[model samples]
Target: MDLTSNRQSWAVVGGGILGMTLALRLREQGKEVTLIEAARDIGGLASAWKIGNSVWDRYYHVTLMSDLHVRNILNDLELEDDMRWVETKTGFYTKGRLLSMSNSIEFLRFPPLNLVEKVRLGATIFYASKLKDWKKLESIGVCEWLTKLSGRSVFEKIWKPLLRAKLGENYQHASAAFIWSIIARMYAARRSGLKKEMFGYLPGGYRRFLQAFEKRLVDAGVTIQKGTCVQHVKRTGSVVKMDTADGFEREFDHIVFTTPAPAVSKACPGLQPREHGLLNGIRYQGIICPSLLLKKPLAGYYVTNITDDVPFTAVIDMTALIKPEEVNGNYLVYLPKYVDATDEAAFSRSDDDLKAEFWPALKRIHPHLTDDDLITFQVARARNVLALSTLNYSESLPPVHTSIPGVHVVNSAMICNGTLNVNETIQLAENAAVDFLKLDSRVAADVAGSRCAQAV
Candidate 1:
């Protein structure tokens, strides 16, 4: 009973955060794995850049105190020293002014909402804070649910703008459950004692975490084939056939598709227009990173949230969030804009174009900050591949195990609620590995070369 490349082979598609974490675990268990990445680097969505003897994350990624899965992985890699937690700033920019709201005093007396509205908002959020399970709330709309419970004014001012920022034009149709999940995480999880609380970061930025993962993965003997894409996946009786980018045909015993649903449809086109209809329904948004090499701190807060005042959704100052000293007189910022599938205008625009558009919004957010404070700046937009998780899009997400026997698909698109942190990615990956390894599937042992006999 021997399994060679001809007999037992496992392939992991996409070398993003999710794929890399899963690949490391699979290789440790003595499984021969091929982690294929189209990108030259391993960090996918959260990749890093080098600048003047230092590296910074493509987009800011922070580890929550509640991020246990990421913590475990860090410990496993023995990279505890590389990580350092710092208390970052969080503020709201509303109606032509910047509000430094780091405490309850600011909360009870915020300018946007009147006193009665503030009291109601407090009570409603406090109530929403309690409800962890959204099963019953899923059927209802967020607008209706919040208005009925929290009052219409609160929804119009706070929730409406917040939803508009995240989901774009699709906010009204969004599930109350989805909205509540975000609120619950903000309220329930405490980084410090404060609710709607604190966030964490690694000392050398997220590049440290990515490097740690890469080192461990290489050490674990996982074959990382970078700059390669899997073109097609076909099944011929027992063996799974793959057509790669370089016109090479690889036959595998098991295969996992960690690419986005859109990519999945392209790779396995035969399953689509029918059986795997969910793949066609999935949507996604594009994110932009605007890192400013500045002479001084842009704002006192790391997270500068926005409801109104400009076209940009939210502005993030990374230097304020991570160890500011490491940033060395430079400020890094990230701006997220939601775009539809056919609308490639935002995605197609050059980084210079993005900086042009986004630069005005920054001025609007903080008018007092002069041109002299800004030294040099660059905007880095990723070649995005993750899917948009709308309302019950989770229900529509393609599971790890496909209807077609051995094809497994797992990506951020599958994740419905909760934060899309590295920790969540690891959990999703391991669960997906179990499904592909057939550990989650109950099969009577008639292993005909990794193909379980379907009951006749």
Candidate 2:
């Protein structure tokens, strides 16, 4: 606990919540911490942008009642008082009709599934929610597991479309644990209170929260370097050397990489072939989300699941959950398409091109919506938003401590048992920081012992 005697300096790469959280914790433990971010601002995927005249999240994000990790961070920052919770409604766009599916009554009357199939579907959700052992579910494919439990009709009508929407072509290879975690989280939220699907959001989006977080980090004696990309990372015995894009290099006692696994391989090429292979072997699904500022609501539902053939995966009316007054009384809608990262066509499309292509589908979902109602449109793309949770995913994760001494790798890909989200990311950072500090302590002790032996 006497960290002052050790006096080790640490470099936390990547400015996402994970990196920021780890940096803060490490600093609190008396470590000299430096946070390097590639972008001008922090927050990574959780980062925000100016929408029309107001600032909002680039992609859709919500805090659930079960997100204790997120709540803890908010409490620490004293931003918990700014949280606004709302009971949201869900819609389903199937057979070319937009229908509400928020409550039991709507679900029972849903036309896609018969009464028997609906009952089977409910049973499947209940069973998944009660599941305590997720390891066994990892070996089973989602498609196979859902079909077996919910029956083929329910699987095809309900599970398949949702899986496709979130994972694109990788859904078939996903493990049953993928769906299990989602079901469990949603179930926990309902059980927490009024049995309603309520989500929380900060009044000024995450901008104010992130600004406050940056101030806290700076105030805690942490060095924050923004708009700096780390070009290379090389570990030399007890010291880790990092070279930046601007041809600047510095030495640190420890380094924590919070970027994607592939980025780690690129930064530190000295890693063993097996280590590099493990990092590179992981696949990710990218997202092209377009946030539209509209004058009116789209479907009057927070999230509208798209089951029919549509360009985008889902339509999220952020204004439905977030009050219109928050965004200058303008409705905010997000159309997100989850595609394979290798899909060049999807990634190459310009914002204007996407808007034109997706506008027709938006019209189909909301017939009342018109061009006159549109205020502005912005497109945001993330290459590695969610890791493809395939079979044996947990076994494939690389250790936090890599083969390179004084260097560590921690990112979203390591989240195998659960879905990729802010809460899970924060939890991973907290756990990784503990492991990193423990390893650093052992290494420091070993170095001191070696020096004493040499003196003798």
lDDT of 1 by residue, 119-220 (tens): 888887778778866766766777888888768888888878877786677677677776676676666445435444557777776677778888888876
Q: What's every prediction's RMSD, in angstroms?
A: 3.5, 1.7
* Candidate 2: residue pairs that collide: none
lDDT of 2: 0.89
Q: List where candidate 1 sits over 4 angstroms from the true fold.
A: 1-7, 51-54, 191-196, 382-386, 440-444, 448-456
Q: 402, model 1: CA deviation in Å?
A: 1.8
Residue by residue across 106-125, what tens digits does model 2's lDDT show?
A: 88899888889999999999
TM-score of each: 0.90, 0.97
The worst-scoring run of ten residues by lDDT in candidate 1 lies at: 1-10
TM-score of 1: 0.90
